[model samples]
Target: MSSITVATWEQLASAFYQHGWVWLPHFLSPALIAALCDDLQQQQLRSAGVGRQQDHLQNQQIRRDQTAWLDGSSSAQQDYLQLMQQLQQAFNQRFFLGLFDYECHYARYQQGDFYQKHLDAFRGRSNRVLTTVTYLNTPESGGELVLYDEQDQLLQRLPPAAGGLILFESERFPHEVLPATSERLSIAGWFRRNNSLQGMVDPGT
Candidate 1:
């Protein structure tokens, strides 16, 4: 959190309040970014699925990328998680979001890979309150994240760049990853609220 000063938090807060989403360039330190990039390359990734848990299944027509969940098994991962924890605290203090925890996974897209427009969460049906993404490698071309409003109107097309971070309301924006001309790497994460009941903690996927 020391890496992200109070002024930086204020800027993030202001931007998030003004819009449903915000993008911050060079959000991660170069050393951390390099470490994450190396870590991702060593992971065993599987074809990404479309849905969650029981309903989860591969659908290449919808998305063409590979993924591996992060478990804080390495120093780079632990550091990244700590930063996110600080961010969660900041959001809770500023917006009263009641975020309970964070979950993330490394995603890799090779040439021609893409994910079609989709919503990260559904209102009243999901505990995920916010979506976050940090790019690990900047592809020479393609692989932009395109966001759309509730009315299906285009909002922004963001290019993937190392150390860049993006945050948006999970259920409010429909977004997609354009096909990559080269390889692309990134971490996709979510800030989730607890939805446990009857003494059982809700499972996060």
Candidate 2:
């Protein structure tokens, strides 16, 4: 994979702060990301849910705990190290104070599997700043990301695309995945700042 250039990182932060979300194009190349996904070994799809969701979809989640580069190893551990370096630099600016944690994830939404609308960060674990999901495989049909507007209208649709990512605010918006006709593969986790960074000063200012 080619090194991530600075301009891309700048754009990512800019988009993130503005819309409370951002879609970095080809953020991680498919082949490299895919190879990593294939190498992931899991004990079983364990239950790690905290809220209730509409039935008709099966959900599975696995968490990878890593404090730093050498703290752990996975198919994508090193790659995630690179990811953290860029994220640390990008989020260290004045306005954003959300702390970053290393809990890499593997999520599969298989046939009839769906996640109901919900936010990742709540009052107790209010540190979840951004919800990040990197697509490993796009389904043959169905399984589009559904994000809601303030009025709770289904505002946008994200067709699954390998290497494609959907990042959004953990508090500002509610998101869900529609039930899939086929299998959906993805990697998702959160990056929290040291503090909530509720009121931030624009570094540009």
Candidate 3:
């Protein structure tokens, strides 16, 4: 996989600082996307849960997608992780975000599936600071990611485009995945700060 250029990283930082979000088209190489998608076909996905671990539960009424967490168990996953490490470094240098870790999962939305508007993390509750979604397949219909502003007003509605990336402040944006009329695939991830309690770091999901 090729490296994410310094100019691109600068643009990402500038957009995040100014707009609370940034959309980067073609963020991932086509080869990596293809390899990841191919790998996804062999994995078993379970009903995606809402809320953090322990608080986590499957609530189809709120979210209907299925997911599989990435465990750095594959070459494709490791390549993606290395790229994210570079991004984390760039973000820290440009914005001083103090992001210490990253976690991601493969998400799939079949026909009629949707995830209702929600926040990735709540203030004073979790360590997740940024959300990143990398679209892998372009569906024929629906599967749009709708983002809302602080006042709950619609900000942007985006359709899935392979190789595109949707990034935003996890706590600042209220977003939802619209019902998909066809199958959709994406990798969803978060950048986190260490929220250690006493001597143990909080278990983030």
Best by lDDT: 1
Candidate 1's C-alpha runs over 4 A off are none
lDDT of 1 by residue, 53-170 (tens): 8999999999999999999999889999999999999999999999999999999999999999999999999999999999998999999999999999999999999999999999
Q: What stretches of model 2 exceed 4 Å from their correct place?
A: 1-3, 41-43, 51-71, 123-125, 194-205
Among all candidates shown, the one with the greatest TM-score: 1
Residue 35 CA error for candidate 1 (Å)? 0.5
Worst 10 residues of 3 by lDDT: 196-205
Instruction: State candidate 2's TM-score.
Output: 0.75
> Against the true structure, what is every candidate's RMSD?
1.0, 7.7, 0.9
lDDT of 2 by residue, 1-205 (tens): 3355788777877887787777865777766676656654432455345432332232343221111112235546567556755665566563555455544456677677777677776665556676787777767888788888666787678888877767777777778878888877777676664442567622100
Off by over 4 Å in 3: none
Query: What lDDT would candidate 1 get against the real structure?
Result: 0.94
